[model samples]
Target: MSHHAKDLLTLAKAVIDTEIAALAALPSRLDDDFLHACETILACQGRVIVTGMGKSGHIGNKIAATLASTGTPAFFLHPGEASHGDLGMIVNGDVIIALSNSGTSEEILAILPVIRRLNVRIIAMTGNPQSSLAQAADFHINTGVDKEACPLGLAPTSSTTATLVMGDALAVALLEARGFTANDFARSHPGGRLGKRLLVHVRDIMHTGTEIPQVPPDASLQQAILEMTRKKLGMTAITTPNGTLLGIFTDGDLRRSFEKGQSLHEQPISALMTVSFRSINAHNLAVEALNLMQEYAITVLPVIQDGSVIGIIHMHDLLRAGIA
Candidate 1:
């Protein structure tokens, strides 16, 4: 590459290295204060109100969102806006988490008296523990970094990144403390792919009634093939007269029969079907069906209910629904 390109790459690497170093140094500083912050948020009966100014506000917004999504009820309040009648959002039981790298943001400091008057607890995250904001808080979390990634040290680079990481750490700690499960996460994110994977059941996507490819055990191989072709499932379920599943005849069975020089038109399907097959309950999640398919190397499974075949699920069904 050219000399100018090499110089640009060097500068980018320096910025990344500086941020990496800042993050690496953070764990040693996560002392009793970190635990106290987590406990305070966990014990909060009301919402967590996060506030900051400028770039700190941007990081605070993300922190609030992360906390909200991970079992803690939190929302961001612009410090400037909070002073202008928005301070009413705070209540006696609420917890305020204020972010300010310098620990003396005028907007944040402006609302301190009102917050104190309302009897709300404060958790200050700042680079300077001795700053007025930290000293005023019930708890202080030091997000101090040695230097900024910006060359002129005028931009909030390493400080913002460190603050964001600290927020994530806090959210995750609270999530684990609450015994939060994937099901809980799905409830909060019902519109996303995670919801589909965690909440969608076999019955939700499985084919039932007329859509199920089935043939009586006494039916001819030609009849089974016709049923499979008509249903377009690449296989046919062999059932007894009372609709109890007996076995399954699939395309693999047909290929083996052809190799054995068997008569496809005359033989009973029961004689060629595999009696031992994997099946899943209709109430199980769609992700379970995918796991069963991968574990047994099978593409389709019959959905069972009360010892009878209720529905059938295919790998394609899971894939089409974005569950796979």
Candidate 2:
């Protein structure tokens, strides 16, 4: 390789190595102080206000987002903006998380007096535990690493990565403690794929009403095949005299019957159908339907309610909706 290429590879490797080492060194830092920070945030009735400067600000913004999404109500405030008049956003019941690798971000420190006056408890994340911000904090978290990924050792790299991970750790710990469910996560992420996975129900995607592929149990095999073909669900439900689902017959069963020399026109679907096939509830989650299909080694499941066939769901439907 040319010298330029080799130099680029070396720099990339150095950056990754610095970050990996910094993360590996974080386990020992999870001490009583981390628990104290979580406890403080949990006790706060208002939102979490995170602020920092430069790259720390960027990491703090992401941290705030993660916290908000995982069940904690949080928002990011620029320290400079707070000093300029945005400090009104912070409430007395709120908790403040301030990030400064050196523990002396001028912008963040400038607003400390005002935040203290508001009486919002502050948690400091810094490299220097003895710095002014750290000393003044209600609880201090050490996000310090031995060095930066920058070759000149001046840019924020490993320190930022460590801070972000620590923030996630805190958010996830609080998430578990609060019994935050997937439904709660979906409410916060209604526009994202995660929301779709959690919010969309089986009835939302299942073929209902006339779209349901169903036939009476005593119906001829030919009639069941016609229902399957019309619905395009690759399967037809066998219903009892009272409209309760008795069994289901799919293309696989049709093929097996043909191989057994059973005449399609004369055979009864109830005799040919899989009598003990798995069924799903229309009110269940779409994700649950996906799991049922996978576990039974089948591509289709009949959705039933009160023993009556209400709809049918196929693996293709789940995939097309991005659930699988």
Candidate 3:
């Protein structure tokens, strides 16, 4: 677009290309050390303690959050704080994952002896595999990058990305090993949309008793329209006297019947009702009901079990419950 804008785009692309190269090389570095790091964490009874210095500390905090959310009990420990009273946080049966780009950060190195004395296992992540920390640890994950995305080579760009990726790899591997399912993930994220979709059932949000709009097969179209208006569900379920669901009459059915010039006042609802109606069970997931609604291009569904209409679900109910 402009001279300066073109230069900016070129520089941005160059940075992305550099980081892409760094990440492309990261997979080749994962060997026995990566597997051992995973195995050790899996066998660990205590929580994982992630420690690092500066920008690596920021990345470690995120890594810890990812692991903690994905079935791994983990937290980030600032290495500088660990040198002080925070060192007491490490205990027997716990595992330490230390991150240091130079492999010899003073704050991180200062806690090595204390971790050793406490009989804790250390998994060192460093840019140099031959660094002092890597050589002394039980396992090492090399996150080395040939160069930085920053043209000045001062900022930790590509290296941090590589380290974060490696941390994600470890968390995912452990998640798979533990057989972590969506339900388990939802349990950990109870307040999020994923939890709502998995945990909220049709019974939790469906309208029941008088709240559901319903009428008999012999109900006049006007009677069904009044039921729909009173319940405000835009539809009414046609049920037998014994509560057996037979069909449903929605606004679409009314429109089609009216277009045919039928006598709305005298016509029975069953004459224009949709007999092949989709239904959901009360115990089924509300998200499943939403899928059914979307598949049939309908906005409402009757909750039926054994041919009896027990409840009804509206698309708005799903939206209110955060399931849609």
Candidate 4:
């Protein structure tokens, strides 16, 4: 390789090594102050206001989003904007988490007195424990790193990563402390895939009424085949006159019957149907349906309600709805 290429590779490895070493040192820094910071946020009745400037501000935005989605209510505020009018967003019961690698950001320090006057709790995430911002806060979490990943040592590299990880640690600590569950996380993220998996029920996407492919138990196997073919669901439900489900006949059963040389046109569907089958409730989650399908190696399920066949759900339905 050329000298230029070798030099670039060397610099890249050095940067990666520096950042990895910084992360490796972080576990030892998690002390009583970290626990106290978590408790302060948990006890907070109002929102968490995360403020920073420049690169710190960008990381602060993501940290705020993570906290909000994980059950700790939070939003990012620009320290420069807070000095003008955004300070109104801070209230008595709220908690302020300020990010500054140097622990002496001028904009952040400018607003510290105003935050104190509002009687809100302050948690400072900084690289320097003795800096003005850390000394002024109610609690401080030191995110000090041994060195920057930047070759020039001027850019914010390892420091920003450490700050982001510290923010995640705080958010998750509070999440566990508050007993946050997947259901709660889904509620806050209703538009995402996890939300769909947790929130969408079998009834929400099941085919019901005229759309369900079903036949009476005494119907001919040919008639059950016709029903399944017409509905294009690959399976048919056998029910009584009162809409009570009895059994199910699937394409797999047809292949098995043909293997036995059974006459499809003359045999009763009741004789061909599989009485021992798995079914799901209408109220169960769509993910549960997917799980049931995977466990039994089946593609479709009859949705039951109060001992009656209410609807049918196909694997394709869950796939189309983005649940599978």
Q: Please report the candidate that would top lDDT against the real structure.
A: 4
lDDT of 4 by residue, 201-303 (tens): 9989999999999899899987898999999999999999999999999999999999999777777899889999999999999999999999999999999
Best by TM-score: 3
lDDT of each: 0.92, 0.91, 0.92, 0.93
**Per model, how many backbone clashes are there?**
0, 0, 0, 0
Once all C-alphas are superposed, what RMSD does model 3 give against the true structure? 1.3
How many backbone clashes can be found in candidate 4?
A: 0
lDDT, candidate 4, at 78: 98
- Segments of candidate 1 deviating more than 4 angstroms: none
TM-score of 2: 0.90
Lowest lDDT 10-residue stretch of candidate 1: 262-271
Ranking by lDDT: 4, 3, 1, 2
Error of 3 at 296 (Å): 1.4
| Runs of candidate 2 exceeding 4 Å displacement | none
Q: Please list the residue runs of candidate 3 whose C-alpha ends up more than 4 Å from where it truly belongs after superposition.
A: none
In model 1, the number of clashes is 0
Question: Residue 301 lDDT in model 2?
Answer: 92
